[model samples]
Target: MADLIEKILSIEGGALAITRDTAAKLVNNLVQNGEVKPEEAQPLIDELVARGEAERDALREDLAAQVTTLQNTTQSIQTMLNANIKEAPERAIHELVLLGEQITNVQDRLREAEKQVEENTRQTLGQAQKQLRIAQARLVQATEEIRTGSIDEA
Candidate 1:
C-alpha cells in the first residue's frame, strides 16, 4: 500500500524515491517512539484541526446567543423595576390616605362613645339627688310630729 501511494505521488519526475526498506525502517522508528504512522497521522491531524475549528465556531455562536438573551432579560427587568419605582410614591400616598380615613373613623366612634358615657353618668347623678331630697323631707315631717307630743295624748 505504501508502494502504491508512493508511485501515485511519483508522477512528477525527480520526486523523492522511498524504497520498501526505507519505509519499513521509518515506520519502525515511529512505532518504537510511540508515534503514529505518517500515513495515518496526517489525515488524523487534519480531521482534528477541522473538528476543533467547528467546535470553536459553535461555542462562539452559543456565547453570542447567551449574551443577547441576557441583555434582553436585563432590559425587561429594568423596565419593570423602573415602572414600579415610578408608581411607588403614588401607591404609598393612596395607602396613607386610606389609613388616615380609618383613623378618623375610629376617633369619631370614640368621641360618640365618650358622649354616651357622659350622658349616662349625668342621668345617674340626677336620680341619686332626687332620692336624697325625698328622704330629707320625710325626716323633717317625722321630727315635727314627735315634738308635738301627739302620741302621748293618745
Candidate 2:
C-alpha cells in the first residue's frame, strides 16, 4: 500500500532483488498506462518473476538430467562397440545398406514433392494467364467504344 516496496524489494534475496525490482517497475508501468489494474500490480509482478525463476530452475534440472543420460548412453555404446569389435566390418556393411535405403526413400519423397509443386505452379500460371487475356479483351472493347463515341460526336 505504501512505498515500502522499494526498501524491501530484495526480500526474495540479493541476486533476484534486481530481477524482482526490474519486473516490478515494468509491471508498474502497465498499471500507470491503464493496461493493468492498480490493485493487481504486486500480484502480477510476483507471479511473473517467480514463474520465470521456476522455469529457469526446471530447465537447468532437465538439461542436467539430459546430459547425464547422454553420457550414460554413450558409455554403453562404447562398451557395446568394444565387445563387438570382431563384427565391426559386418556391422558397417549392414549399416551402409540401411543408410542407402534411407537415402533412396528420401530422394523418392523429395521428387514427389517437387513434382507436386511444379504441377501447382503450372496450374496457377495457367489461371493467371487466362485472367490476363480476359482483362486485355475488356480493355480493347472499352477503347473501341470510346473511339466510336468520339467519332459520332465529331
Q: Give the candidate number with the greatest TM-score.
A: 1
The lDDT, on a scale of 0 to 1, for candidate 1 is: 0.67
lDDT tens readout by residue for model 2, 14-121: 224446667788778778888778888888778657755776787789999999999999999999988799688888999999999999999999999999999999
Q: Among these predicted structures, which one has the highest lDDT?
A: 2
TM-score, candidate 1, is 0.62
RMSD of each: 12.2, 31.2
Q: For model 1, how does the per-residue alpha-carbon lDDT over 90-129 read when each residue is reduced to its tens digit? A: 9999999999999999999999999999999999999988
- Model 1 is weakest, by summed lDDT over 10 consecutive residues, at 12-21
lDDT of 2: 0.76
Give the clash count for each candidate.
0, 0
The residue pairs that clash in candidate 2, if any, are none
